[model samples]
Target: MLDRGTTSDDDDPPLQKWLARRGKMSALSLAELESCKNYTFQLGRGPQRCSDVPSGLTNSATLLKAEKNSPTKEGLLASAFFASPGDGKGKVRFLTFLHQLGDKKAVVKWDTAVTRGMLYIQLPEDPLHECSRDSLVELLDVAEEFSSRAIVFFSKKRNDMKQLVRTFKFIGFDILPPSCDWIPTSQEYFFMSYEFG
Candidate 1:
């Protein structure tokens, strides 16, 4: 019935207990974003080298750049960049575009929410004062193209767990449980997640 911490279902192999336990286990640390202003332009993209950035989401950039040739910094559609603050509530710069990931079809919209844990995504309100419908559709299409299977998380305030769950559900993404942890740091933490296909 059980293996280690995992339980076996009638149709599935013996459940790996550790997997079951850790499956929903979340770790939170107060991470302040480092700035991208200093990032170098590689083939027209900022911070061209993934190794230069911190671990975690930076690795995803490798795939991002590979899929779309370097876009002008000013021309970048959507992105989440590190904030300059070293501690206490860092900021992330998220830019939106017509068709961000280079896909020519399908429109995708952007939404933001926060989880109780430290992980977080930063999403500001619409920046463009007057964008053309074609421009907006193009941005949405690009979002759909780049975010084939990716998920994003945001935090507006601290310890709003219920808000997090509601946001997750609103976005139609699956929620794993009990993985949230609060680790204090010099700066405030933000919850973030991205699912890659």
Candidate 2:
């Protein structure tokens, strides 16, 4: 594990100050956050698979099938795959947890996808007490409803990488280098595909 005691030459700006006006903290600044001793996800590939499999984002058809078969109300709505909260139109949306590489703690979002495998915009975690462990359980419950397998978290932050290495030892995923346009500040971003052994 990385040491938290190292002091930087100067006190870096608070994360809030560096975030985009809409609320996204700079993905590049994860390294700075690491200096503060907080744990966050790293960018990189996940575990490996038995046979070769594509590492890119899962398609809409697959996502829809996953949603329809999901056991939980939340998961059935495809909230786990989207980046925005609640379905537009005010209906309760899905909850998502994003582990930005090099930052501490995962960010929870209410989100939607712009494309099949990409998010349009990821909303910030709710400051109110609504998003506690119980909320996470509720979110997973929906996913469990349809998904036959465990939901895997993919991260690029070093800490997240460690967590993945620790938690998913039995599974296989591929950690691939990100594509050209996806410039993440972390050393690498990870791609996790669910694997069952």
lDDT of 1 by residue, 130-175 (tens): 3223333333233332232223333334355465556545555454
What is residue 165's positional error in candidate 1, in angstroms?
2.7
List lDDT for all candidates, in order.
0.27, 0.29
lDDT of 2 by residue, 1-197 (tens): 22111222222232223211112222434343323321222122334343386534221111111121213333213343232224321111232333222233543443322221122222222332333333333333332222222323333444445654544444343343445222122333344333122
Runs of candidate 2 exceeding 4 Å displacement: 1-93, 96-141, 144-155, 171-188, 195-197
Q: Model 1 shows how many backbone clashes? A: 28
Tell me each candidate's TM-score.
0.25, 0.24
Worst 10 residues of 2 by lDDT: 59-68
Best model number under TM-score: 1
